[model samples]
Target chain A: MLKKRIIPCLDVKNGRVVKGTNFVDIRDAGDPVDLAKHYDKAGADELVFLDITASHEKRDTMIEVVRQTARDVYIPFTVGGGIKSIDDMRAILRAGADKVSINTPAILNKELITKGAEIFGSQCIVVAIDAKAKGDGSYEAYINGGRVNTGIDVFSWAKEVEKLGAGEILLTSMDRDGTKDGYDLELTRQVSELVGIPVIASGGVGSLEHLYEGLVKGKASAALAASIFHYGTYSVAEAKRFLIDKGVKVRW
Target chain B: MIGIIDYGRGNMSSVEAALKKSGYKFVNTDDIGILATCDGYILPGVGAFKDGMEDLAKRGLDAFLKEVAKTDKPVLGICLGMQLLFDYGEEHGGAKGLGLIKGQVKKLTTSFKIPHMGWNSLELKRESSLLSGIVSGDDFYFVHSFKVVPDDDSVVVATCEYGEEIVAVVECGKIFGAQFHPEKSSDKGLKIINNFGKLVERC
Candidate 1:
C-alpha cells in the first residue's frame, strides 16, 4: 500500500529555526540543518524547511542550510517560503532539495506554477495553500503568512493549481493553525477531492489520532505539524508506530 | 576502484557518497576507459526505461558494458539500473534493454501505490556474495513503478512483498542487480554496497 507520510516542518528565519507558540512568541529551536538531521534520524518520512526571514542575509543562509542538510540527509526534503522565481526554485533544487513549495509567489503569478513545472518536472513542484473559513461557510485563500486574503475559493484554487501542473498540494487551514483541536477535515476533504495530485494536510496535527484522522477521514496523503513535533510532544517514530498499530500503513 | 556508470539519472551521487562512506575507492564515470580499467562496475539509474537505455546507447557504453559483463568482472545494477539488465521494459510503450538477464520489466499492479517509494523488508530467496552481510527482512529504500520479472527464477537473490512477490535483488554469475538503492537506504543500503565492494575485492 502507499504508506502514509509523517513530516516535520522547520520554520527557518535568519538561518535558524524559530518555533512559535500557536504561530506567535517565536523562539530559537536550533540550527535548521541539525534539527533536520535529527528529524531524519528519527524516521521522518520527509522534511519541509520554510524560510520565514525577509532579509537577504537570511535567505542565502537558509539556502546554505538546505544545502548542508541535503548533503547529510538522504530522504526527500521540500524547501518553501519566498520562492519568487524559477531561478529561486533552481537554486534550492540545485542545493539538493527534492521539491520546492511556493505559496505567495504562486498566487501573485499563477503562471509561475506552469513555468516552474516546465523547467523542473511537475513532481518537483508543490503548491501550498493557506485557507481560512469565512462567515458565509466558504473558505478563502490567504497569502504572505496568512495576512493577505486572495478571496479565492479554496477548492477552485486547488483545482486550478493542479491544472497548472502542481504535483502535490500542501493544504493548511489558518483557522486551525496551532489549535491542536484537530485538522480542519472539511477543508482537507474538499481540496483533496478536487485535485488528482497528492494532498499534504497541514496546520493542526495535535496527536497521533489527529494524524490518523487527517489521513483516514480527511483523505490526506500526508500530514505536517510544527509545534507538537518541534516541542518534543510527539516523536515521529512513536506516532508512526501508533498509526501502524491502528492499521494505518506507515513507513517505519 | 569501482566504476559507477553515470547515465544522467538519479542515484549517482547517493551511490558515490555511500561507497566513499563505506571506505571503498570508487569513481562515477561515463568514460569507457575508466570503466574498462575498474575492478568492477556499478550501474545506477532512476527514471523511465527507454530514457535510461537511450542514455547508455548514446554514450556507446551499452556495448562496452555488455563486453565487460562477458568478462566475469562482477557488475551490479541498482534500481532502474537493475531493470535495465532485462530484455525489455514496458514503461513508455515498450523499450529494449541490455538483455543480460532473461526477463521483462513490467509495471507493478500492486494495490499499494503507483510509485512504491519507501523502505520495505526484503525476503532473501537465495544465498550469494551480495547477501553476505545482508540478512532476510532487512529493509531497503525503493522508488519505482515497474519491476523486473526474471525469466530465470534461480537468479533471484531476494524478493519483497507489496501486493505480489516482487524481485528485490538478483544475482546471476558475475552480474548482480538490486531493484533498491542500497546507497540511500542508510546502513542496510550501505551493507549491500559494501558486499558488492567485497565481491570486487575478491575478483
Candidate 2:
C-alpha cells in the first residue's frame, strides 16, 4: 500500500522563501531552511523548493538553502526552478536534494531529460510540465514559469519525457493556478494514465476536498500545494486526516 | 561507529544527516581499512543495481562487504544498496550481487506502477533488532523499481503490500536490509537508524 504523497512547495528567491503568506510561529518566514523544517515537523510527506531567483549570480543561494535543509529536515525534498544544465542538477543533488525538477530546460533541450537520467539515474530526474488547457479539450505545455507557451501538446510531451527516462512528472495546470478552484482533474488523469511513472498534481488546490479530488479523482500519485498550507487554511496533518477518512492512504 | 560506504552513489549527505540526528558517530569512506575499523557499516545508495554494484566493486567494497557478512558486526543496506546484498539482480540486463544473503533482485511486476515511489506500511513477519520499537503498519519512504526475492524466507523481517507482497525489510544474522529510505522517513525512520546504531554499540 504505497501512500499518496502530500508535498508543500516553497518558492525560493536569492536564498529566501517568497510568496509565503503567514507562519506566526516561524521567526524567519523568509528563510527557506526554517520554513522547510516547519513543514517537515508538520508532517509533509515531502517538500519542494522552487528556486525562482532571476539572476544567475544569486543562483548559488538555492544550493546553500538545500544544504541547510538537508542537514535539518529529514523528509525527502526536491529542488526546482532555474535549473538549466547538468552542472546545476549535480550541484543541487550533491547538496543533498532527493530530486531535481526541470521544466523549461527540459522543453528547450529534450536531451537534458535523457542525459540527466543517464548520469544521475531516472529516480533523480523529475520532468515538471506546466500545462494550460486550450479550451478545445486539449492542453499545451507552458514554460518560462508559465509566461512562454511551448506549443507542445501536454499529452505528447508527457509521453516523450517518460520515453526520455523521467522518473516522475510534476504536472501543473496553468489555467487553475492561483484560482483556488481546484486541480484540472481531466489534465491530471489524462497524463497519469498516459505515463507509467508517478505523476504529481500541482496548482489550484483550495480545500482538503480538492486534495482528495487530486488524489482520488485526478488519479495522481501525489498532490502538491503551497497557499493552502502556507496561508494556514489547512495543515498537512489535517489534509492527511481528511484524505485518510476519505479512504486515501497517506503517510502519517 | 558506523561506516557509511561511499562509492559515488546518488547521495550520501542524507544518510550522514540521519546518522548525526540519531546521535551516532559515523564516517563516510570507501577505504576498506577505515570501514574495517568501524563496528558496523551502512551501505546506502540510490540508483540502478548494476551501477551500484559496479561502484562498490570499483572501490573493492563488494568483497569486503561479503567478508563483513560472515562476522557478527551488523551491516545495514538501504534501497539499491539493499538490492546489492542479494546474489543477483535483473536490473539493467543482469548483474551479480555481493552474495551476502541468499536472494535475487527482480523488477517489480506489479500492475500498479513501475517505481513504487512513495511511503508504504510495513507488515512485520518476525521480530528483529533492526525493527526495535517499530511495529506493524509503520510507514517508510521507498523509491525503487525492483524488489528482492530471498531464497530463504526466514531472512525476511517484514514485507509491504504494493499491488503484491513486496519485501520491505530483511534480517539474517548480523546483516540487515531495507528497501525503503529510513533516513528520509522522519521520526519512525530515525527510530530504525537509532536501533541499528545501538546494535552496533552492543556489537
Worst 10-residue lDDT window, candidate 1 chain B:
B111-120
Q: For residues A1-252, write the lDDT of model 2, one tens digit per residue.
A: 889999998877677666532211222236788889999899999998887654355677788889999999999999998889999999999999999999999999999999999889898999999999899999999888777888999999999999998999999998887778999999999999999999999988899999999999999999999888886899899999999898898988
lDDT of 1: 0.83
> Best candidate per TM-score, number?
2
Tell me the deviation in Å of residue A27 in model 2: 16
Best by DockQ: 2
The candidate 1 chain A region of ten consecutive residues with least summed lDDT is A52-61
Candidate 1 Cα errors over 4 Å, as ranges:
A20-24, A54-59, A84-87, A105-123, A135-138, A156-166, A190-196, B110-113, B131-138, B163-165
What are the clashing pairs of model 2?
Answer: A1-B161
**For model 2, what is the alpha-carbon lDDT of residue B77?**
95
Query: How many residue pairs of model 1 clash at the backbone?
Result: 2
Clashing pairs in 1: A1-B112, A2-B112
What DockQ does predicted model 2 obtain? 0.87
| Candidate 1 CAPRI level | acceptable
Estimate how well candidate 1 is docked, as a DockQ score: 0.26
Interface RMSD of each: 3.3, 0.7
Q: Candidate 1: deviation at residue A152, Å?
A: 4.1
Q: Give each prediction's root-mean-square deviation over alpha carbons.
A: 3.3, 2.7
